[model samples]
Target: MSGFVLNERLEAESRLVCILGLCQLRLMNDSRWPWLLLVPRRAEAEEIYHLTPLDQTLLTFEAGETARALKRVTGCRKINVGALGNVVAQLHVHVIARNPGDAGWPGPVWGLGKAQPYDTNSADALIRAVVKEL
Candidate 1:
């Protein structure tokens, strides 16, 4: 167990779908991809280096698990998992399922276009699907 919890802004900005074993699991607001965010429960952790070795291993495991689950559900041609704290400044990893012809293909999923928000039912359905796997 960790001493930290999910950030307020992150929870407010996205829909939480499932609980990954070692992290806070959230579904991104953007509907363009089957995207998930995994944030380790480390107090005030703003970078990967802030984590203890054991926590780092836990984050890696969570990220890999998220990537595998997303791949299995979405059948994406590729999956992107990374942690860049420039914007949110939190020690979090992103797991995105990407298709070859997605909104941003052969490139990063950041800042490509306006985010297409998922419909309420769609979001619920996706969340349930992910939860079933979790």
Candidate 2:
């Protein structure tokens, strides 16, 4: 467990939020969407199946809670939850809040447009709101 460390790419792309039961919750820095990443703290876990059964169950619960919180905070038209580790390969689940007219509305947010990083004030506020829900 002590060997567990956040992937550097993930660390650069997101801000640390509070930890859930089995994952370290992170707020993606892009302002284009309200997104959260749930990363299990198990070391060398590059895939969902790498987790123990209990950890896998906890990850699912954490992902659901994150999706609900994002929906309540962003009031998005829909929520997108996925675990595509093709790029980062760090076993992270993405919970994205999507609106009908949002950029790449009908598609994935990846590579849609330049990421608009959140301002400190907005980031802090959002973190507070979501953490409160969690």
Candidate 3:
């Protein structure tokens, strides 16, 4: 897409880790969970079906790869992958590493608790590690 600007809400919430074949790999600012977001660079794509056929498939591939990378980095027992655009309405996939005793526990991360913003040093280190994995 030519003018594929990131949604403002997402831009305000996350930092760019890298770009993938069909999505922009971003690190969610919250430190409580090792979370990543994959946003497809398609203009006005509010849903997965809004993307081109190739883009839809590419999004799945990129999201899965991101999840594996996140799991390796966090060593989490479970991975939560989803695309619930109820609020931001952007076509972004959430690749979150979950453990048994996390803040959200068995519930979804969204709206469970306040986000703990990552420290600058921690953010940089994680970004470097994730980029290397990608």
Query: Model 2 compared with the native: what TM-score?
Result: 0.96
> Candidate 2 clashing pairs?
none
Model 3 Cα lDDT, one tens digit per residue, 4-66: 999999999999999887889999999999899999988889989999899988988898788
Candidate 2 residue lDDT tens string, 1-134: 57888999999999998977788999999999998999898888998989989988988889988999999999889999889888888789999999988889889998677889999999999999999887
Selected candidate, larger TM-score, 1 vs 3: 3
- Lowest lDDT 10-residue stretch of candidate 1: 1-10
Candidate 1 lDDT, 1-134, residue by residue in tens: 44686777677767776666567889988898888988776788988888888888888877887788788788888899888877677677888998988887889887678878899988888888777765
Model 1 alpha-carbon drift over 4 Å, by segment: 1-5
Candidate 2: deviation at residue 107, Å?
Answer: 0.3
Clashing pairs in 3: none
Angstrom error at residue 33, model 3: 0.1
Report per-prediction Cα RMSD to one decimal: 1.7, 0.9, 0.9
